[model samples]
Target: MAGFLSSWPWENLGKYKYLLCGPVVAKVLYSRMEEGTFKEDWCFHISILFAVRVFHHLFWSSFSNMLFLMPDRRINHQGYDFKQIDKEWDWDNFLILQALIASMACCLFPTFLESIPLWSTKGLVTVMILHVAISEPLYYWVHRCLHRNKYLFTHHHSVKHCSPVLHPFTAANVTFLESLLVTAIIGIPILGSCVMGYGARSAIYGYVLVFDFLRCLGHCNVEIVPHQPFQTLPFLRYLISTPTYHELHHKEMDTNFCLFMPLYDAAWKTLNSKSWELHKKIRSSAGKEERVPVPDFVFLAHMVDISAAMHAPFVWRTYASFPYTMRVLALLGWPITFVITMMMWAWANTFLISCYNLRTKLFETWAVPRLGFQYFLPFAKEGINHHIEDAILRADQLGVKVISLAALNKNEALNGGGTLFVDKHRDLKVRVVHGNTLTAAVILHEIPTDVKEVFLTGATSKLGRAIALYLCRRRVRVLMLTLSTERFQKIQKEAPQDCQNYLVQVTKYQAARNCKTWIVGKWITPREQSWAPPGAHFHQFVVPPILPFRRDCTYGDLAAMRLPDDAQGLGSCEYTMDRGVVHACHAGGVVHLLEGWTHHEVGAIDVDRIDLVWNAAMKHGLKPVSSSVTEQQES
Candidate 1:
C-alpha cells in the first residue's frame, strides 16, 4: 500500500502529466470569461497560489545553478550526474498536488470559501505562532519517525535521500506519501489560524514564501549565510538552519532532523558538532580575499548559435549532459533565448560557464558574451576582441597560468589568431595559447600512415598550412586545392627542399576525384563532395561540420580528445562532443598548463613541434578520439 501510494497517478503520462491540473485551470479561466472581471474566489486564489509556487521553485533552481558555475562558491564539491537530474525532474509534482487539495478543501469547508482580507498584522502573527507551537515540532517528529521506521524509510522517504549532494530542486524531491505529510505540516498552521479567527490571505502567502525560502536555502549547496550573525548573537543559530547545517544532515543521516530550525535538533541532541566550524571554513574559502585560489587553466569559449545557448550547463543540466543535437521541442525556447542574446550582446561581459578538476589542477570554461554569427559581423569584430582581451587580462591578473582561445576567438581575421594580444601585452606573465598545435597534430594523426596521396582544402589557412607541411615532411604526395598561387607557394616554400615536390597544388575539386583521403579544413557543398570517388573518407576541422553527402563515403567528427580517467566533476558535455571528451584545442591548453611550459602558443603553428605536442598529450593520458581514418568509416 505504501509503495502504491508513493507513485503519482499521472506519472506515466510523461509530458502530458500537467493535464492533472487542467480542470482547475479551465474552471478559473471560465469564471474570468463569464464574469468579465477578476474576483476574490477559490479558483482565482488557488491559481495564484500555484503560479507563485512555480515561480519560487524556478527562481531558486536558476539561482543555485548560477552559484554552481563559480567553483569557489560551491559548498559541496561533488558534482551532480544526469541520473540525479532526471530523478529530480518531477520535483514540482508536490506543488500541484497541494494546490489540488486546497481546491477540494475550499469546496468542503465554508470557512475557506469565505472572503478574506488581503493583509492583517494579527493574522500574520497568529500564523507564525501556530507554526512555532505546532508545525515545527510535528514536522521534526514526523521526519524522525520516517528515518527510524524501516518500512517507511525504504518505501516512502528513501527516494529523496538518493541525491545526497543537494541541489535547490532537491527540496521537494519526495515521494507522494512524504509530500502529503509535508502538506499537512504546512496546512495545519494556516488552518489553525483560521479556526482561531485570525486568518488573512497575507498570512497564507507569507508563510508559504518563508517556508519555500528556507527549504531552498538549505538545499542550494552553497553557503550563502555569513557567520557574523551567529557570532554577534549566538541564539540566532538555534532559530534558523544554514546550508552547511542541512548538508551535514544529508551527510550524516542520523543527525539534524529539524525542518527549518536547529532549536529542536539542539533539544534532541541531534545537531552535528562540526556544523558551525564547517560553515565558517566554507565561507572563508569563498571570501573575496587575495587568498582565494585561482584556476590553473581557463578554456575561453562562446555560444555557437541561439539553439546552442540552451545547452549551457546553467540553462538546462539534463540537456547539456549529452552530445548536443537539434531537437524540435527546443524550438519552444527560442523566444527566451533571443531576448537573453540581445541583452548579452548589448551589456554583458566575460563570465564563467562551468568548471571541473583534473587531479590537483583546477580548470574552468569562461564565455565571451557573443555568438557564432556575431563573430562574422563587420562591425562586431572590435567589440568581440575587446571582450576577449578583457578576459585575457583578467585571467592574467588573477594568476591564471594558461587561457586557451576556443572556436572563433582564435580567428585569424579577428585577433590574428590571438597574436595581437601576445604582441601587445609582451610583459604579461600568463601564457596565451591558440592551442592549434595539438589540433593540427590530432588531424594529422587521423590520416593513415600508409596513404601515399591526400587531397586537402583550405590549404592556405593556419591549421591547413601546418597539416600540409607535416604531411609533406613524410614524403607523401599532397594535392593542395587553392586558387591563390602566391599563398600556396608561400607555404610550399616552408617545407624542406626534398618534400616541396610532394606538396602539389590543385585549383578545382575535380583534381581530387582520384584521391581517396580527403582532409576538409573548409566547408564543401554536396556538389563539391560529389567529386570524391567511392569509399573516400572525409576528415574535417571545419565548424558546423560539413554534411555527409555520399552513401559510399564516411565523415569524421571535429578534432576532439577524451580527458584522462582522473578528470573529476565533469557532469556536462562540451558542446557536441561526447561525455568526458573536449575539443582537441581545449585539450592542447590543458597539456600546456600541465607541462608548465613558459612559451606562449599563439599565432601560426610550428611544423617542428607537431610530433612533440602529440607525444606529450599521449604521455599525459589525453587520447585522440579519431585514431585513424578507417575507424570513422561507416556503411
Candidate 2:
C-alpha cells in the first residue's frame, strides 16, 4: 500500500489541486463569476443577490471608514470628521493594552490548569467554580490596565479608537493580531477550564464565542439596552460589558473599565461607578437623555461598541470575491444563532439608514448646484416647507398671530435699508411693523405705542412656517411676523381648511437669518410689519430653539462644538434662562422651545427666567439647531 500510494500521491495531489489551493483558486472562481461561467442561479435572483451584496458592502465599508477615521481624527483622506469631539472621546485603547500584557497568561495559565493533578470530581467542580470566580477578575484587572495606561493604549489597543464613531464593520477595525492578543489574555481562564476537564471543549468554545460576542455587543455604536436594568445593573458590568457597559469606556476619562464581566469590577470597584450618577443627573436635568428622543453621543458610542462586538465573530461569512460552490454560514460546526443574528440585524437596521442620512447630509446639501444623481437622494429636504404668500393666507385662515419685528440682522445691516424694508414690502404687500428694534427686546420698551398683541410667529423661512403652524390655532388671534410677501402661502396644497379665518392677519417683514435689508426703520417706506400695531400683547419664541448658541458661534470655548450640530437651536431669548439645562416647564410667560430639545432636567431658576431666556432667543432672530437635522432613526 505504501509503495502504490508513493507512486500515485503526486497524481492525487494534481487531481485535487483546485480544492486544495487557496487564494489562487478563489481568484479563479471570482473571475468565473464575472464571466458567468459558473452557471449559477437564474439571472433575476443573482442580480438581486449581487445588488444586496454590493449595497451591503458599500454600507458597511463607508460606515467602517467613518467609524475608524472619525474617532482617530488624523485628518487623513476623508477630511475632518467631528466624531472625535463626542462625549468621552477614545478611552478604550489604554484598557485593552493593559489587558494584552496580562493576557500573555491567557495561553500559559490554561496549561497550568490542565496540568493540575485531579482525582475527585467534587474537587474538579470546586476548582472550576474557583476558576470562574477568579477568571473574570483576572481578565478584569488586565482589561482595566489596557484602558488606563497610555503606553498600552498607543502600541497595543489604539485601533479601537479609530472608530470614534463606531459602525458595524468598525468592530473588526483592530489589527487581527491584537484581537488574538486580547483573546489570549482572556483565554487563560478558558484554557484552565478545559485543562481541568470540568467544562468540555464545546463549553470553552461556547464561552469564548459568547464572551467575545458580549464584548462586541457592548461596543456596538448604538445602545441596545435600557438603563432601567442595565441602567442599574452594577458589578456585572465588568464581567460582561453590555452596550451601555462599553459606551462609558468611550465617554468619560478613567471611569468605566469592566468589560464582558462586571464581578471583578464590583470586587475591585472598577466598574462604571460614575455612569449611573451622570446618566441620572443629565436625565434628571433634561429627562430626555433617557427618553431617547434625539440622537446624541451616548447613543453613538453604544452603537459602535455593539457593532464591533457583533462583528468579531462574523469576520467573513461570504466568500471574498470568489464564486465558491456554496457560501458557508458564519458558524462552522455550531447550530445557527438566527435569533442572535436577527437581533443584531434588527438593532443595526434601525439606525443604519438614520446614520447614513446624518453622515451624508453635507453631500446632499452641497449638491444643490448639481442635479445628475443627487436629486434621487432626498435626505437633505427634511422639514415642512411653506412659502411667504402661503404663510400669510394660513395666518388669515388659522388665526395665528404674526409679530413682525422692526430691524434687520447683522447680515442685512451690511446691505441697504430700502431693500430690507420697502423692497420686500412691495414683494409681500403686507403692512410691516414700523418701529425701532433694540438689542434689549425682552425689556419691551422698544415696541411702538399702539400694538395690541404680538406673537413671535416663526420666521419667514421654511422651519419658521412650521413652527408658526404649531403655535397658531383656529380661535386665537395671531399676528404673523415674517419677511413681507405679496401673496398668502399654503402650508400644504391640500391643507385642512382652518376653522376660524377671521382672527389672524399675516404680516411679512424681513426677519432673522434673511433680513436682506440694512437697518430697518419706518422711513424706508418699503417693508414694515403692517400687522404689529404700536401697542400689542406680545411674546417671542425662537425657531430651532434647542441649542444655546449657533454652529459658527465664537463667543468663547464651547467644549469642542458638535459643529454643524446634528440638531441644535440658537436664539437671543426674550429673557434669560434663570438656570442651565432645565427640567420643568418654564414658569415664566415667554419661553423659547428648541425644535429637538424637548426635555431637560428641572433646575432652580424661576420659570420666568426660562421665559426670558426663550424671549432672548427669539430676540436673537431665528435659526434651527441643524438646518439639515430632520427626524432620525434611533441612535
Put down candidate 2 lDDT per residue, 136-198, tens digits, no spaces.
Answer: 556566656766777666655565665544443344444434555555655565455555555
C-alpha positional error of residue 74 in candidate 1 after TM-score superposition, expressed in Å: 3.8
Off by over 4 Å in 2: 1-131, 147-149, 167-171, 199-201, 227-240, 278-352, 355-635
Q: Model 2's lDDT to the true fold?
A: 0.32
Highest TM-score, which number? Answer: 1
What would the TM-scores of all predictions be?
A: 0.87, 0.32
Candidate 1: residue 109 Cα off by (Å)? 4.6
lDDT (10s digit) by residue, model 1, range 93-193: 88888888988887788455475677878889999888888999999999999999999899988888898469878989998888999999999888888
What count of clashes does model 1 give?
0
